[model samples]
Target: MLIAQISDPHVRPAGQLYQGVVDSNRMFEEAIAHLHALDRRPDLVLLTGDLVDEGRSEEYAEARRLLAKLSIPYLVIPGNHDHRENFRTAFADHAYLPATGALHYCIDTHPVRIVALDSCIPGLHHGHVDAEGLAWLQRTIEADREKPTLLMLHHPPFTSGIPYMDSYRYIDTAPLEAIVRSVGNIELVLCGHVHRTMLKRWAGTVVCSCPSSTTEIALQLAPDAAPASYLGRPGCMLHLWDEAQGMVSHVSYIGKMDGPYPFA
Candidate 1:
């Protein structure tokens, strides 16, 4: 099974740019085209979060229009920039998303079981999964302990070295970590919101934070470096699962670039 992960397009209304610089809508279009052109098309696409910029109805409408172009099936979770109600109403056809309360859901797809948790706190930049949310997650994972599972969420449980981004890292992650440790079936934890590709090992599973589809956060490791982004090549992660190898991930950069030169 092939699963593609795209994150943080931050789509805005028509004729608008994200942060007055990146052309997010256009970038997303290019990303979708890239996915469509893949030789081995993805079986499923996991859009981690930040589906829109302002979380407005119009933006979601535009997002729906753009995402509709995808030939592959996809699922979405809310991010810090996303409004729960707006997101729920925008993608109401998903059926997987809960009609009320948190947008947490579980998918029992072939080869892997996906458990997406709602980590967004309305009107806040930080993320938290309350005790109630944690209970749901525990129950969901415990029910199917034998299946290989991928736990998806918006905010990462670990902090990126980028000081600016780490400042607002997910709060109250200990409980979530403990749950994963106890369940022992989570193969990986997928996240977005850092706008950069990051990998870490926690609770006996790999946690991967994907880069943005629009722009990339500058790789400034300095504690005092200002928060900023660059128009570097955007990308997505492709996860391949096989009975022999289990799951492996690869990053595919968007847009046409240098040739695949052969080494003599």
Candidate 2:
């Protein structure tokens, strides 16, 4: 099975730009187009969060309008920029989402199992999974200990050297890490919110944080580095799963580029 992961689209209303500058909606359109143009079509698409810029209904409407161009099966979880109720109402047709509380669920139909966690702290930018959410995860993962699983959450589990961004990560990760460490069947833990590509070996598996479809967060490692971002080579994550290869991931950049030259 193959899955394409796109994060932090931050879609604005029609005629508006993300943060009133970058044309994130158009960029997201390009990302959808890129996915559609892949050599081998993906069986599913995973949207890691921040679907809309400000959690507004109009933004979600515009997002849905742009999303009309995509025809693949996709799953989405809320990010800090998303309002839970508004997001829930926006995708009301997605029956997999819980009717109330955190937007966490598990999908078992594919060759690889998918478990998505809602990490947003309502009106706050930082994230956390309360005891209730963690309890649900523990039960879900514990129920099926042998499936090739992927854990999806908005926040990457490690403290990325991007100091400014790390300030907004999920608080108190000890418990979540414990649950993940207890499970050996989880092939990878996929995340977003850092807006740049990141990888780490964690909990006896791999954790991959995808780049945004709109902007690339500056990779500053200094302790006092200030927050900054740019509209650079926006990209997404392509995860391929097979019995022999397991989960192999690649960062697929968007927009046109000079390539396919013969090996000299």
Scored by TM-score, the top model is 2
For model 1, the stretches where C-alpha displacement exceeds 4 angstroms are none
How far off is residue 1 in model 2, in Å? 0.6
Task: Report lDDT per candidate.
Answer: 0.92, 0.94
Best by lDDT: 2
The residue pairs that clash in candidate 2, if any, are none
User: Whole-model lDDT for model 1 versus the true structure?
Assistant: 0.92
- Superposition error at 82 for model 2 (Å): 0.6
**Distance from true position, residue 252, model 2, in Å?**
0.4
Report clash pairs, candidate 1. Answer: none
lDDT of 2 by residue, 1-264 (tens): 999999999999889988878999999999999999999999999999999989999999998888889999999998999999999999999999999999999999999999999999998999899999999999999999998999999998789988899899888888999999998999999999999999999888989999999999998999999889987999999999999889899999988888888886
Candidate 1 global TM-score: 0.98
Model 2 / residue 101 / CA error / Å? 0.6
